[model samples]
Target: MSQKELTIGSMTVFVSQPYKVPQVTELIGRNEELELITAAWLAGPGQLPLAPLLLGEPGVGKNRVVHEVARRTGKDLFIYQGHEDVTAEDLACAVRFSDKSDRKMDYVVSPLVTAMIKGGICFIDEIAKIRPRALALLVSVLDERRYIDSTLLGERIVAHEGFRFVAATNTADLEGNAMPEFLRSRMRPVIPVGYPPREEIDSIVRSLYPRLNEHTGKLLDLFWLEWERNGQSTPPTPRDAIYVFNLALSLADFESLGGLRAMSADGEPFRVDQPGSASSLKESHLKRAMRELLPVSRENRP
Candidate 1:
């Protein structure tokens, strides 16, 4: 698939893969706004509100859930990743030296502004990472139903009727790292997505990866079971399951190199927990491997 790009002011953001939103009817049985938000996007232009804040810790599929929702909703998504240095002008537009002009002057619209103009779904990620000043610029857009044209630019930029807003943030210890109550208030509904349940995750993995034979699936299940038992209260999510499966595939080749012959009664690599080998599945080793691939469950939960 072609890598997509969205213009944010003078900068450009490269989009990753196209998301596959879960079915709204299904939505993995979670009451989270994930299904509704994505469903609104699917309904197309001018159907939903401008503000819906998605909050959660990192790597819990917050972005993916939104992307899937957007995909399912059939809305063109304009993604902008928030950073510490981002400012209000960055969300709107900035003055640039136009090569065509001798005075070196022109105002270029940013991704947020362009999304507003084009009526696309504007996805602002990691919003809490940005400073308060940068976030303050959204006050008008979020509340007044209009945007203030920067005094420097000297032109009012009104959002298109189709513009929709979705912002995501991870919880933080620092005050600046949390979305201010003022901004949070503008969003009528704040959605918090928790990690997927084991059964739901297993279902997602199975749907996407049916080729994984029964032995491999069961091995992964055992790994998850062990991790849940020893790790903190939170368990490894489905995303973690995917990582373990990938790691095992790599290990299959490594076993061949180590001269540990791959032996399977049915012509497939033997499951890691098969009979005598179960003792080798240690908690410490599993935790370390999980930490490397997936975010630690305790830190990421909302």
Candidate 2:
């Protein structure tokens, strides 16, 4: 096993790869948003990369945009999922007992800390979910002083020259408990990630599920039908659109396959883990799927 520590001054900080580098490289119709993020990363000596907040509702492509930026930058991406229970130690570092070394306690660097040490992009998802106390750990890293002090290790972990930071939060969460002013001051110009246009929605579907190319446009039409039918308050997000097409494809396959039972690997018993056999999506299969994904008026409810 390879060692995972770098001695910063007298303190040894162990690092870890918490989340996999994203393989998704398509941003569909987010050119302007991507450009903004890419420009924010251009920092020179004595300057800090702009720490921007990706503001959107759930299911928008905020996370995917960050992943593609990391890929384009040729830098390893580390994702840290923020939660209500996140603490300062969780943001920076934590000491854990080693499995290989006779119960010796070792420092485990967080995704945020690992990116700081490894000169990569650290995208914290649902950042507003983290408590203010925990979120405060990023103050130094977001400003001209690119470093984080870990109380757990009693060490100041300075970010490498190439390290970059971005955060994402849902609209509802931001309304509940406003982010502390200190953090808000550091994370400038929150980038609102609005829903992609119908064309872009179709493009995203084609990119993700090319097998449904023939019916993607029709499926998108039904998607908007439901979007309008639901009073347009909270339309179907990109994620909802994807699920609609995915389920529609599955439903088409079920009809094509005569709704056969999902059998076990041995073909002895029915399998409960799957939704049944799948196939390419069809236009007719989309109406019901769209209804399920987006709320419809009572008269049109399935």
Candidate 3:
């Protein structure tokens, strides 16, 4: 992954290509636009562990909050992205072969399986995407505080004392509405998240793209304002602001002309693509990008 640095006023921004899943705590602290999620666990009345279900709209940074919490707790994170095809083996281990028969009998551990054994944090993103069967694997693990024997592993594996689980979902659609009641019974303290306020979003943009000048900052503000006012296909999100900043950085030439004054090609801060080029991109595309980088729109306006 290559990292690009830029200066926005007094702040310096590091833009990395192939954006890494930033360490949880770093992402949580780097961006202010987020909320902590809590949920109930089915282990028992008082016995159930507090398995926080961080809920938010897509790109609203739910996973980031969980990641930070894991880091702050000094737990190793084992992440699993839930999808339709996810299977028990996907969560645990599956059989793999080796050319040499000497060490042939082996089972590879999935992140979830390893996390349970090591007593680390298991983060299942978009847990609802997983089918009932795939999710069934977790019922025992989350409640009994033990891992089941995988045919591949050939034995029941108990969890480490430090073992914990955190699942995230963007349940905005009816398709992935909620976890099954049985599973929901296991979750404790469900925390719902909404988009952040404008000022907070501005702070996040500044932190992520520190080198943006007042002019460039205002340029971002304009795009945000436009989206906020129109409520068009894409609403400005923290993600959107960061993306536009990165785009501005790529499109703007601050070198030869020197310093902040160099951003303008012909005396104007560079705009991404052409005026109407946004038409070529889907509203969902713009919204998705902005949700990650920009701020939510102002609420008081029409």
Candidate 4:
């Protein structure tokens, strides 16, 4: 994908493209959170859209929920990754060397500005990591003002009527580095995403890997057993559960390939007899995947 050129004012700027949504069966176990976000973005005659902040532990599907909402609403989704070093200007626009011979420099707009200009959904991931000084720019955008000023462009860019904003951060990040009071006050209806329950985890896994439907029950049992054996107080996150099953499937495939290679060396006709099939996933493979991917030491166990 290439940068899109648009005229902001007297200057021509390049806007960022929307994020391509990934292929997922569906968003499971997040209906309530989804409703909260959607409701917050609703505006009436005298009301402005609310900017919702999603807070959850890492891998608890904070971003997934937002992506699902964006997909359902049929909005162009623009994502901006927040870090400690991001400057206010970086959030609006930046200058780059131009590809065209006629222009010496190109003004490139950030994903946030692009969403604002195009009336799309802007999701800032790990927004708490950005310094308060840099985040100060969002004050007006989140309020009834609905505009952001770019010093470099010398333009006060107003957001489109359809422009919407949302942000997310890990629970740990908020505890360590709090957002400024002004920004926090403007971002309404803070949504907390907790870990999914056992049944929902099972459903999510089966939905993502339909090939393992036959063995999904036993695999889920093993997954819970591993979590208990590791002395984890919290249940397994969706991501942790998914990784275990994905790795188990990979392990089965590797072993099956090894067997086929040996048989071919002995002059046996090469054939895939249920090779890498879900039935080939044994308890040992699941255990090995858990040990490698979800290992918890005594010092780190909580």
Whole-model lDDT for model 4 versus the true structure?
0.88
List residue ranges in candidate 3 displaced over 4 A: 1-48, 99-101, 173-178, 233-235, 253-302
* TM-score attained by model 3: 0.68
lDDT of 4 by residue, 182-206 (tens): 9999887899999988888889999
lDDT of 2 by residue, 40-153 (tens): 889897666798899999998898888778877788888999899999889988887777655477777888989988898898999998999888878888887888988778
The lowest-lDDT stretch of 10 consecutive residues in candidate 4 is 270-279
- Candidates in order, TM-scores: namely 0.69, 0.87, 0.68, 0.91
Prediction 2 TM-score vs. true: 0.87
> Model 1, residue 56: displacement in angstroms?
1.4
Sorted on TM-score, best first, the list reads 4, 2, 1, 3
Cα lDDT, model 2, residue 81: 93
lDDT at 173, model 1: 24
- Per-residue error for 248 in candidate 2, Å, reads 1.2
Q: Across residues 158-265, which tens digit of lDDT does each residue of candidate 1 receive?
A: 777767788887755224536677777776466876787777777665665444546546655667775665455665555666676555444444443442556645
Clashes of 4: 0
